[model samples]
Target chain A: NAGVTQTPKFRILKIGQSMTLQCTQDMNHNYMYWYRQDPGMGLKLIYYSVGAGITDKGEVPNGYNVSRSTTEDFPLRLELAAPSQTSVYFCASSYGVGGKAFFGQGTRLTVV
Target chain B: AQTVTQSQPEMSVQEAETVTLSCTYDTSESDYYLFWYKQPPSRQMILVIRQEAYKQQNATENRFSVNFQKAAKSFSLKISDSQLGDAAMYFCAPAFFNAGGTSYGKLTFGQGTILTVHP
Candidate 1:
């Protein structure tokens, strides 16, 4: 039941140097998301959480910063990294709002 | 503010033939949900079918099917035997249940449809 578990997976930051793209989920989901896939562009909503310490700001949240403190983590922070902050970062979970959304096997950031 | 339109950026079928991938949406929010995601190049975002705006009954998952035409809001995806692992890159997501703020489980996606299964 490793539903959604994203980690380094791949990275290459340099522009401003800063990284943190790790998501976790064991299905206790309370709806957590952070997406950004930009090469044919299809997934872009970069911050969300609806439980433990709630956080929000999606639709490509600026430079990105998120934290859900508990309930199977949801971390996506790229403090200063630019170059349009690279791309391909996804982490999702759902068990509410009409559940069914679980993805994560991506985190291919490359900000050179 | 809801928008999801996948006017087929790409599509190809042959292997067993039967491929229909097209989605359209625009909602002012009336309790919604519709999805079809499959990004395979190992990008892994697979959740091939789901739809329920008020449930007019149109959602399947064996040979994969969905043709919900909620008053022409249209949600289409039908892949019947065409499997070369069913190619990849096909997404049309829209999950809007914003009763006010904290918009519940927000998801809005489009600009995807690249399925090519030709053996």
Candidate 2:
């Protein structure tokens, strides 16, 4: 089972371009999250969803949007990619509070 | 807000030796959870070990173990018989359960510690 999967392993975008990072899990977890990892920095939560039709902003949610229409997927959207948005993005899911989290391989994005 | 701290930014240990990575957290809630995640060059975050706040006994997984001191808010990872594959970035993360103002399953992570295993 692919616990969690993220698409577009690597991508480069222009300043005003827009894109979406797709994440899906097969574990049927109700809690899903999107995080960004900068060099030498730990992962920073961007957005999270407790279940379908529910989403909340995390520590760093500027310049990003997310949706949870289903339990298996949580996609992150970048409206206007900026240099500051360039970082490695990771998607994770968990069974519930205090449960173990499963992370995807990660997607590396760069904006010039 | 909860926060995790990893004082050691980088460390090196010889192969087959024992090494410890330190971690500390700040939380007002009495019951929570702590975890250690390892990220290799492959960039996949792998769960190494976990500790529950109410469990006095430390958590252990084969060669990996955690020393959880709830009162002091310290949770450290100990690696025995370290191998080359252990060379990677280690993150200390903590989460609260059913905290009134917090989102469920959200984690607070430290800056991370880079471990180098010398052969």
What is the DockQ for all candidates, taken in turn?
Answer: 0.33, 0.85
Candidate 2 Cα lDDT to native:
0.92
Give each model's whole-structure lDDT.
0.87, 0.92
What digit string (tens of lDDT, one per residue) describes model 2 on residues B11-119?
9999999999999988776568889999999999999998888889999999999999887989999999999999999999998655574647588899999999999
Clashing pairs in 1: none
True lDDT of residue B89, candidate 2: 99
Q: Candidate 2: misplaced stretches above 4 Å?
A: B99-101
**TM agreement with the true structure for every prediction:** 0.36, 0.97
> What is the two-chain DockQ of model 2?
0.85
**All predictions: root-mean-square deviation over Cα?**
13.8, 1.1
Candidate 1 per-residue lDDT over residues A1-112, each given as its tens digit: 7889899899999998888888999989888988888898799887888888988788779977888889999888898899987888888889889688888888888888
| lDDT (Cα, tens digit) per residue for candidate 1, span B1-20 | 78898998999999988999
Q: Which residue window of length 10 is worst by lDDT in model 1 chain B?
A: B98-107
User: lDDT per residue, candidate 2, A1-112, as tens digits?
Assistant: 8899999899999999999999999999999999999988999999999999999999999999999999989999999999999999999999888889999999999999
Error of 1 at A107 (Å): 13
